[model samples]
Target: MSTLEIRDLHVAVEDKEILRGVNLTVNSGQTHAIMGPNGSGKSTLAYAIAGHPKYTVTGGRVLLDGVDLLELSVDERARAGLFLAMQYPVEVPGVSVSNFLRSAVTAVRGEAPKLREFAKDLKNGMDALSIDPAFAQRNLNEGFSGGEKKRHEILQMELLNPKIAVLDETDSGLDVDALRVVSEGINRFRATGDTGVLLITHYTRILRYVKPDFVHVFAGGRIVEAGGPELADKLEAEGYEQYTKASA
Candidate 1:
């Protein structure tokens, strides 16, 4: 179990400020939801935590279990047990999903999984998510449908089992059926009760499947409001309009 702490974070992309003095924390076994309209910097925070070069941290510190995260490179951060499930996962043309995951597991764990044992874990993860094993042989996220892409993200989350998982708009393009599958995968990630989750989304539908311990409303690059589960209900009923007006 690990703790992800963001304190007074200020992030900018290409000299344009995105996140302004944002502060949030996700402790082990907890889930925090960041909800905001488009362009509110939710994804910016995600990228910054993953140490994406494009989003520069103009101020503040990101601590993974009290260790400085901003100092490490992207790969080093992943190796330190921080995983970001991108809203749009990249398509690697020549790499199969299995091979990609295998390399990732090896990189993060610092050792390769035994061939037979690794195969068993892969099969179990896919079966748990109802993904066909054949999909493993296909290129990473190439030619995959929207649901498949999201499922592939979940597959990575399962295989990696990072101490903290940051999922950015994972439910964006999924239908109801796909939503169920993706939601189930999220629930599975919580089975260990030690993997923290920072789920960023615009809609409350996904929250119906996975309850959040804290709900935060982001507007204009800062967290404006935060509350318990009912905060999601209020947002659903009254909409971000109220929060937007208030924040304005």
Candidate 2:
């Protein structure tokens, strides 16, 4: 089984400290949720693990199956079974969705897949996410609605089949129907029992649909509380006020 270990991570953006001594571990067959208020550095933790250049890792290490990921480039991290679905997916004006996915699969697999086989797999993933076949020809996220963009991210996670997937605020801006579809995709991924998921969000609505094995509360740029799934219920009931106050 694969394991992603984050050890006392310290991250900064524009030389301003963000994450402070954040520590967590996710193993295959498990899902961990990171919950927090706005500006609690939740997204920073995700970007840092994904090796975003803007978020500098000032201290500690991120290891996937014992290999230090902080030492690898952004694309290299994906090849090592680490995937990051950004909170705000950028629009690629010219690249079609199919082309973008194919390139990503090629990079991660170190070779290209046969056209016929890739086509079949792509169709199946889109079908699962309720994505329109016409979307394959559209520019990547260029005009996709919030729900569509999030669904596309899920499609990528399925195709790439990473050992660990970091979903950063994927639940944001999704309506009820879209939320269910996205949650189902996440549930489908974890059901394989071969991937670990680190779902970062401010609300626990997604958790109700895709339950996590562990829940962490973030405040003041670090995880201040942690527990089982029940912790999420507490957060939903009481909000982040208690945790934020404690951190302050």
Candidate 3:
């Protein structure tokens, strides 16, 4: 089984401290949900884990199954079994989705996938996410709708099958039906029992479809409360007022 442990994570952006001594752990077959108000460092934790150059890790240790992830570059971290589904997927104007996915797979696997097998896997992943087959030929996220972009992110997750997935507000900008489709795609990934999911979001709606094993409330750059599934329900009804006040 794989494990992702964040020990006393401290992050800064533009010389301003954001994450102040945060810690969490996720094991394979488990899903952890982070809910918090805006500017509470939820997305910062995601970007920090994925090695985004914009978010500087002032202090912390991010480990994947006991391996120090801080020592690796972004691409190296991906090869080491870490994946991030960005909230805003960038537009790759010249690269086809099929080509981008294949290249990414090759990089992570350290070898090219056979053409036939790769085509089959791509088709299956797209079909599972309710994405049209023709999307493979289009430039990555170029002119794609918000729902389409989110679906594509999950498609990558399905194909990559990384040890840990840090999804930043994946449910954002998705309509009701699109949200269901995306949530189902995530559920499928969770069923593998091989990928640990760190789902960061502000609302509890997605939590209904993608149940979390643990729920953490983030405020003032750190987790102020931790609980189980019930915590989500509480957040839905009571909101983050209490947590925000506590953090203040």
Cα RMSD (angstroms) for every candidate in the order listed? 0.9, 0.7, 0.7
lDDT of each: 0.92, 0.95, 0.95
Regions of candidate 1 where Cα sits further than 4 Å from its true position: none
TM-score, cand. 3: 0.99
> What's each prediction's TM-score?
0.98, 0.99, 0.99
lDDT of 1 by residue, 1-248 (tens): 67899999999988998899999989989999999988888999999999988998999999999989999999999989999998998899999989999999999889999989999999998887778899999999989888889988998898888999999999999999999999999998987898999999999999999899999999989999999999999999988997677766
Q: Which ten residues in a row have the lowest lDDT in candidate 1?
A: 239-248
Model 3 poorest 10 in a row by lDDT: 121-130
Clash counts per candidate, in order, are: 0, 0, 0
Quote the positional error of residue 203 for candidate 1 in Å.
0.2
By descending TM-score, how would the candidates be arranged? 2, 3, 1
